[model samples]
Target: MNELQNFDFEGNEVRTVLINGEPYFVGKDVATAIGYQNTRKAIKDHVKTKYMREERIVTPSGTQTMTVISEPGIYQLAGQSKLPTADPFQDWIYEEVLPSIRKHGAYLTDEKIEEALLNPDTIISLATQLKNEREGRLIAEQQVKEFQPKVSYYDKVLSNDALMTISLIAKDYGMSGAGMNKLLHELGVQYRQGGTWLLYAKYQRTGWTHSETKMVPRKDGTEKAVLNTKWTQKGRLGLYELLKTNGYLPLIEMKDESAV
Candidate 1:
């Protein structure tokens, strides 16, 4: 910058000059005091500047290009190179990304780095993930972080006819559909065309008090029902039989003869 300033100006007159496209204030008196000039001369003392110089540096970490520009007492450290070659980010690459890339390509070496960087998928994915993460645009749950504290109700209560259905279940070993139906009827459990109690038992309940059994797949990946049986409801078998015969399982039921 000082070299450019020296190269472009030569005069005894303190000519008004522009730096960085703006006029820089310098007095004819102060100009002489600053050893710039004495009288005002527009031509010979004029100092103009343009795009200056650039450098390509290969550091222990990586390679980067920088640019230089001439301004008042100011200078530009980079020109067209958009990537930063300074600390923080630079250190991260040298200490973090480079190792991963080196391992991916085999070892921490330039050749390995070149090959890893050349891979289109890896480069694009890394760039995109970095951008998204910086902007909080990535879907954190995509890989299932499970960070949120899992919340679930644990205590379970058996319904009035639920145990009755389970009883039918045990009798049939889960096959005797008729005894199931009859027991359902005696219990006033509602049903008609299709038996839903046993199926219901094997599945889950969301709105009512939790079922006695939690529905989960076992280690073999096959789901099985396990009973909790903490609380039980005294069932009305009269209503149970009526509903079982008709397959009318209401939210509430009555076992009284008249109600049936």
Candidate 2:
């Protein structure tokens, strides 16, 4: 948890904080800003538990547990909003608030990068620092290339929305890579070639699954072609629902009122 800050959104005071190095908005404040009457109802219906977490924060009285949502959770809630200002609110969050938080959060008035940029000595020192950083990064990459991970049957995957891999889907629901593959097979996914998971032809008929070629470096330091399977947004949501109904996701129960 990071320090909580308040900023105005359409004249409404919205609470924002940083969690795990990423910005998150207070769930109750978000619901209020979006014109929802019941914060708990809005959260329970729309937010994924993985994207929401509870933390104790000190207030005027003492301390209280507050629900906070990551950026993804906020957007998910926005999608469920039926208020007249829903679209504009979503746009304001996406186009304005998020960017400002990301940009200004790193601001340091006493040790400013802009001030350094104006001095020749500082410019030379910065260039040297950048070169060292690049070299360190290259060394790290080379080390990783030298030892590709032994594929785990059940392991968490890390990825963003743009291009999701099998590991990404599995990790989302606390499944292993192998477990996800087995679950997919049970769900009628038939083909998986070269570390890529493929949907059944019937599921693919909707054009929800596709493959793209990505370049991977060989042990000999040459690039090779690798086809990666990706799921469309529709496919991802559908798969999530399928898993949800099947009890693959951990049970998400409402917090006890007394506990809060």
Candidate 3:
């Protein structure tokens, strides 16, 4: 049996155990810490079977069987919680509890420290391992930071389900709508027809552009319905690649000439 460790969260006790070197939390404790009134029900509803298991835990009374959930199960439960303490609970677990468990091996005992201190070689080896691990983590973090802007921009674009007008896409490239239309025409991507811009025959069936009818005021102050073309996210992505291939880039992707 693995050693059972306890952590305090908002005055509640969350018990954890390491199974195969990975931390797993007691389901009841986690549900209570996150303000779930019905712990069993919450765990059943939110956490999947794969992330939870039955474990035998020893208490002051006797050994008892209880449900324990893995780290992913904790996140799954936390994501569905609407309580005010949910975010703080998750933050505490990830930023403090997890790091402490990983670094100190669930909780270091005085006996364990004394054994390590007795061996000079063990201490030196541990120091080297920790140093190498920290260096690797730092390098990975730096790479993630460097790519974060591009990732965020792509995420924003993909998450937006609403269609974009030519003006909106043009604004991203630091060009006016008319300028963008003219550029697309010159590139053979689109053509003007009946006062509306449309994708070429080859591109028409690609689901890139959608046509919507909008009422506009004419010179005689009469309202006339016109077909307005909008671009889908996929279309925008296609256009981005096409423009980049032709030596054009969105303002966000353009590098500073002065810095170069």
Give candidate 1's root-mean-square deviation (CA, Å).
30.7
Q: Residues 1-260, candidate 3: write the lDDT tens digits.
A: 66688999979999998665457899999999999999999999878898899988776667888899977677777766768887798789878887887676333346646766898876666566556556644664454343433444455577798999999998878999999999999999999888999889989998888998999999999999999889999888888778877977677655432233
How many clashing residue pairs appear in each of the predictions shown? 21, 5, 0
Clashing pairs for predicted structure model 3, backbone only: none
TM-score of each: 0.16, 0.43, 0.44
Ranking by TM-score: 3, 2, 1
**For model 3, how many clashes?**
0
Give the per-residue lDDT digits (tens) of candidate 1, residues 5-50.
1111222322222233222223232223233233233212322234
The TM-score obtained by model 3 is: 0.44
Write down the lDDT that model 2 would get.
0.65
Which wins on lDDT, candidate 1 or candidate 3? 3
Any idea what lDDT model 3 has? 0.79
What TM-score does candidate 1 reach? 0.16
Candidate whose lDDT is highest = 3
**Higher-TM-score candidate among 1 and 2?**
2
lDDT agreement with native, every candidate = 0.32, 0.65, 0.79
lDDT of 1: 0.32
Stretches of candidate 1 above 4 Å error?
1-109, 115-137, 141-147, 151-260
